[model samples]
Target: MSGSREEQLAAWTAKTKRVGFRQRNWSVVRWLAALTVTLLLAGLAVSLLDYPPALAAACWVAAAVTGAIMLIWFFDPRRFRARPSGIS
Candidate 1:
């Protein structure tokens, strides 16, 4: 019956909806934070090797801010609605 076919399509579409969306959101945020933490830790590690404390602090702060940005924007990219490259 047509009703049965509709139900099957709906069932399959629901599974896809439950799948990629949350994982993609999580993956972007998680990896961004990991990268930021790595940068901060690397900066800290190199400061004792004469990288300059001010430079190290700046690196960590920059990383933290970038990570925070990713966290905020991970929900939706369309919300930004602008060309980062400045090309309309």
Candidate 2:
């Protein structure tokens, strides 16, 4: 309420960019952990249940592919493009 709208927008944009940068830097570690968990869960499910081998393999492949795509998106700088700072 204090600053002009443009000033406020710029401030918010800067803060978001900073946070995004930090996340990007740590994304590799996060992605690894996520993949590890996903694989472990899939393995556990397959082992504990009576799922068909083919079905279990398919599900594991699908989950792995989806996670990989998401990981790529998460670390992609282009995907996190900040709004133009010309709001004034």
Name the best candidate (by TM-score). Answer: 1
In model 2, what is the error at residue 21, expressed in angstroms? 6.0
Model 2 stretches astray by more than 4 angstroms? 1-43, 81-88
Clashes of each: 0, 0
- Measured by TM-score, how close is model 2 to the native structure? 0.43
- Per residue, candidate 1 scores C-alpha lDDT tens digits across 38-82 of 888878887878977888888888888878888776766553433
- Model 1 regions lying over 4 Å from their true place: 1-24, 74-88
TM-scores for every candidate against the unseen true structure: 0.49, 0.43
Clashing pairs in 1: none
lDDT to native, each model: 0.71, 0.68
Worst 10 residues of 2 by lDDT: 20-29
- Cα displacement (angstroms), candidate 2, residue 65, comes to 0.2
Error of model 1, residue 11, in angstroms: 22
> What is candidate 2's CA lDDT for residue 83?
43
